[model samples]
Target: MKKQKIFALILPVIALGGLLTLNALKADPPSKSKPAVAGLTVPTGFDINVIADKLGSARHLVITPQNDIYVHMASTRVSKGIVVLHEEGGKTTIKTSFANYGGTGIAMGGGYLYASDKSGVFRYKLDANNQVTNPENPDRIVTGLVSVDWHQPKAITLDNDGNVYVNIGAPSNICDELDKNRTGCPLLDSAAGIWQFRTDKLNQSYKEGVHYAWGLRNVVGITWNQQLNQLFVMQHGRDNLHQMHPKLFTEKQSAELPAECMFAIKKGDNAGWPYVYYDWQKQKNMLGPEYGGDGVKPADAKYINPVVGFPGHLAPDGLLFYTGNQFPERYKNGAFIAFHGSWNRAPEPQAGYFVVFQPFKNGKPDGKWEVFADGFAGTEELKAQGRAEHRPTGLAQGPDGSLYITDDNKGTIYKVTYKK
Candidate 1:
């Protein structure tokens, strides 16, 4: 009977795959609106400004040395692909819009703008003026990436060593029980964790110098921490906490069991997913169900532990390490993470619709974290109505040491700065 049910589910997915051929589509241009500037109350010296609004699903952004902004806007019901915004004279001009290719990640390094589509990673050279004069041409840096339902975002970041790290999310919620009441582990035989590739190569497969770290579930936010000189990622935790194993978790436990994690990654390190999790309140490591122990204590000494843990399912989409002198000195060398908010913790009011700051000292967290910015949810009435004006997805720093944040749900980008 279980086999029959599994077969029934597989048939629809196969049919859908046949029906919808994957192709890049052009995204709609930004809607015209008054250049709006709304201020957000931060610390005693900081100021926030609304830079651009009414964009269509703005996901990630990277600023060039010239201060031009290249924003990756996801296609919506009417539009298809990527858009580049050039900033000049206190105004943003649409430099180019490519309707042919689409993906969620974008980065700029080595005088080239790199983007990832459903198929693979591509790179294009930007002129000194920060314009992509050549759109028809892009070097396929990495190819053969899977773009299925579960692990499709393909968030990426580049290290100073010219290595591009891409997160290939796990395709399963705990790998689907082998049998009812049984737990499964990560499938490292295929796509499950972070894969590294050289930025200069084209169409390079994962089998090259591309394997970095393993056992991460979905590390959407990846950045090279300049202060630490290491790779850091914010991981989305596994879901269906209590429903998967009723014997181990209650509904409340499932809703708030595992924590969304911030991991400091090194080559060949395994921050165990489907096997271990960092318990925040308890301030210790805990075993996952797949390896046999209850969700109480750390299971293995071999797995790497997360540097910090957050509330579960807040959907951390962007992370940035502060290196500017604009804000207070305490913000220097600290990290900023944008939580896109919760979708699964339904019966209980959802959480994490804000940005958080974690101070760093000598490549490690110095003390407790704090909410750096809030009120993106708009109003309590709106939240009760199941509607939010924005969901923060991306983070970027401007040339003048100001910070910018993008919201995917409402298609807006905000610039945060300091006044005193």
Candidate 2:
């Protein structure tokens, strides 16, 4: 009877082992899926390949000197703020949550990657293999940046001296107090402008550096021109062209008013926000209705004028001064700006959903601006129902002298290189 009991127990143990072996054989290893196409159309000489996609609102991108692409992805649910993409043999591996904060800005300067969220800025150190292993805990480079209804994603740029410039957007449209459309009721106060800060230090308050430039309503795109050794920005003009003040501005006047400005910024420069507007139709800067000047005059000499102006509300988001030698000779030392396009320019079709090139000669605009790449706005049908496949928001240059453009609407990055 003891032998019978032993046999029964041995049988159960052998059966159990066999079952476990069968289950192990049934399980399969994880399979790799094919990468999806980005669905972007480019010119004949260029190709739009997706480095990364399906990220949560990938706003801005910057590449390191070693050819690694770092994307700042803003989150609404999961805060995977920054994502680093390493590409090898046409395969991309993504390392996410590189930073604790994420906003609409990412820049590489001083041998480190810097990013800004709604609150503050942070830095990271990349190794020789272009891998960011030690991401420093965030240091508030600048605080008290307005985070109200308007002006949320303050874009950031760095100068050669390691000074960081953050675009602090104004909270209100025209700083209107009563919301009743009165002239000169709201004034240009301390709240509406860009603020500069030092990147080498932490916890620097708004009062540390000078309030770099005033009267800039919302300069979203800021970059330092390495060729010129100067800072440049693309301004988002005031809204509600004729809806806010009808008596002062006609529909045609309102449609073509508020010239989007590109400024070569300097210390103590004021671009005149609430005090004046640039009228493209008149080809002159005019005083703002709030300041009681008619709509057909030149801007005040006390205020600095824009180096170049664009149509109203094109929403320039990405600006880059090309220093690469891969493209044609004319592209060298020039600027490429990506307009995010217009939303309020209704009754008239929306414009500026493409990349534009402005030639520069001797540190200034040498020729008229032209559309460098088109077909971003796929169709012209009003009230059509389809997703805007992409909206260009960031610009970066690859180590091979190719240009990289990123779209926020769909998280796709395109590397553009010249053929032949």
- The numbered model that scores best in lDDT is 1
Per residue, candidate 2 scores C-alpha lDDT tens digits across 29-138 of 21234233322344445544555545556777877665567878765343357766655555554544455565888887665677887755676665666666576564
How does model 2 score by TM-score? 0.84
Each model's TM-score, in the order given?
0.87, 0.84
Q: How many residue pairs clash in each candidate?
A: 5, 1
Measured on C-alpha atoms, candidate 1 has an lDDT of 0.72
**Which clashing pairs does model 1 show?**
25-80, 26-80, 26-81, 26-99, 27-81
Backbone clash tally for model 2?
1
Q: In candidate 2, what residue range of length 10 has the lowest lDDT sum?
A: 4-13
Error of 1 at 192 (Å): 2.3
RMSD in Å for model 2: 13.8
RMSD in order of candidates: 10.4, 13.8
* Top TM-score prediction, candidate number: 1
